[model samples]
Target: MLISVIIPCYNSEKTIAEVVSLVIEEIGKMKGYESEIILVNDFSSDNTFDVIRDLCDKYSSVKGIDLTRNFGQHNVLMTALHYTKGDIIVGMDDDLQTHPSQIPILVRKLNEGYDLVYGKYPKKKQSFFRNLGSKFNDFTVRKLLKKPKGLVASSFWAARKLVRDEVIKCKNYNVHLQGLFLRTTKRICNVDIEHRERKVGKSGYTLRKLLRLWASCINFSIVPLRLSMLVGFIFASLGIISSLIIVIRKLVFNNIYLGWSSIMAALFLFFGVVLMVLGLIGEYIGRIFLCINNQPQFVIREMINVEEE
Candidate 1:
């Protein structure tokens, strides 16, 4: 079996070489499987492409794909999927947090009749904010994507070639890989893996980027829009009921008072609900516009050790 391991790199110049070497050594230990490493540079501002290019030149099995610009981690992975030619595809971050040695565990699960296997960390090695963000992400995935209970989505995972092909078939600009994974297969499992601290710089995901990723889920599911509609309906119903009560009190008992504070509170609450519903609808429309325009997922600027098929 040909095993293709894809690593999405940003400004990971410090750890790229060592990470590649470790992946090679780990895959080397598993005999009877020809290993190939595909390092995709997401237009890192550092010399990450140079390091990957050098590695590609040194090792025939190592390939380098230099993206035109930073398309985020998931988009980089999407582009890499088009080039993978293995029976099984393994994806992990450029950072060494996901140790290469843990890959075989995912592979073992995949071999036992699972289409996809995620490497779940017992204790994720991340900052408090990052962990919080991850929890929020998981929650959103469960609510919006209807993901199975207890299914953990991690960057380090193995998918059969069939899953990879289905994923690559997706052409929309806003790509949520976890959503796609859950939509594609129910035969998924997770293996516990040790998450190590980063050997290099911190994560490329800033607070803004993390929120952007979360917001992009609007393209994948309409649950957000539906929830917004439900909220609007509930608020509108409450408003009508309150207005009727006020009118009845004024007519029958003459006890209704047009208090400025109450009026202001009602205005603020209803306006907030309206603005929220508009924003959610706007997000869906915006994603549709981008998709209709055919936005290129990721532009490739250069490639090394990539054989033209």
Candidate 2:
């Protein structure tokens, strides 16, 4: 059996070489499995692509691709899927946080008739804000994608070529891998794995990026639109009831004053709700336009070690 391991590198020059070497060594120890390592440099502003080229020269099983720009992690992974030649594909980060030794566990779970398996880390080693973003992401996945209850989706995952093909067939510009995986199949499982501290630069996550990730989830799922409808209905009903109460008070009791403060408060509250709903709808429409315009998922600048014998 052939296994293709894909690592998405971004500003990971410090640890890319070591991480690739460790992954190769670990894959070598697994019996009856030939391995190919694909390193995708997502336009890193460092020597990450240079180190990957050297690794490709030293290791016949190593393959490398250089993207034109930073297309985000999921976009890079989706791009690498088309170049994989293994019967099974594995996805992981360039940092050593997801140890290569844990790969066998993910593969073992896949062997048990699962289409996909995620390596779960009970105690993550990320920063506080990063953890918070992850938690929010998990919550969003549960609500929007209807992911299995208590399933902690990590970056490290293994899947058969079937799932990989299905995931790559998704042609949307806004892609959420977990959402795609969940939409693809329910025959998924998870195994606990160790999470190590970063040995190089910090994570690429920022407040803006995390919010964008959440927005991607919204783009793929109609839950947000549905929730907006619910909110709109509730607010509309409340406004009607409030207006009725005001009218009844004015008719039953004389000299009732609905002052300017109350009027301005009502106006502000209603307009805020309206604007929020409009923004949500506009996001969906905007993504649709981008997709219709055929936005490229990623542009390849260079490729190396792809023709290994």
Candidate 3:
């Protein structure tokens, strides 16, 4: 059996070499089959690609993929999947935190009759807001995808090549791995894996980045748009009831409709609700517009590839 380990790296100059070395020493010697590492550089502005080149030079089995530009992590991984040649493939963060030590365990689980096996970090180290955002995102994903509650998802995993093909076929400018995880198949499992702190540059994911990710993710799920519809109905009902009261007071109680200000306020409120509902609906429509246009998710300025023997 051949295992293909894919490490997507971007500005991870500090810890990548060590992580690659660790995987080579600890996980590459497992029984039954051999393993090779495929490190993809997502157009980093640092010496990351050079470092990967050096490593590839030192280790003949190591493969290096250089993206023309910075396609988001998921995109980078998705594209890199097409180049992988292994019976079972593993994807992991280039940072040392993902723990290559678990590669053998993950592959072992895959050998025992499982389509996909992912890592579950005992604890996520991030700020309160960051953690909260991730959990909320996960909750939204589970509900939108119609899965059980608290279904955990992670980056590091081992899976058949077919599953990766399905994921790559799914095209979207904003791709969420967690959503694709469920969309790929109903048979997915997670195993406890060791986690460690980043031993290099700070994480690229920030609050603004998280929000962008959320916006992209939510568009794929219809749950939010459904909630928007329910809200529109409630607001419309309230608006109708309010108008009835105004009419009743004007006809029965007189003297109460004595103000142009109230008339203007009612018009504003009515149109405001109408516009809001339209805006909500338009969000979904806009995605349709983009997809119909068939825009490219990323532009490839140049490519770096090494032919396999």
Evaluated at residue 306, the lDDT of candidate 1 is 87
> Each prediction's Cα lDDT score?
0.89, 0.89, 0.77
Query: What CA RMSD would you report for each candidate?
Result: 1.2, 1.5, 2.8
How do the residues 1-309 of candidate 1 rate in per-residue lDDT, one tens digit apiece? 999999999999899899889988988888787789999999899999999988998899999999988898889999888899999999999889999989878888899999999999989888887888888888888898888888889899999999998999999988888888888999999889889999888888888888888877666688987888889889989989998988988999886578999999999989988988898788778778999999989999998888876
Model 1 worst lDDT run, 10 consecutive residues: 213-222
Clashes found in each candidate (C-alpha, N, C closer than 3 A): 0, 0, 0
Per-residue lDDT tens digits for candidate 2, residues 70-167, read: 89988999988889999999999989999888899999989999999999998999878778878888887899888888888889999999998888
Question: What tens digits encode model 3's per-residue C-alpha lDDT throughout 176-202?
Answer: 766776777777787888878777767
- Between 2 and 3, whose TM-score is larger? 2
In model 2, pairs of residues that clash are none
lDDT winner: 2
**What does candidate 1 score on TM?**
0.97
Candidate 1: deviation at residue 266, Å?
1.2
True lDDT of residue 11, candidate 2: 88
Q: By the TM-score metric, which is better: model 1 or model 3?
A: 1
By lDDT, rank the candidates, best first: 2, 1, 3
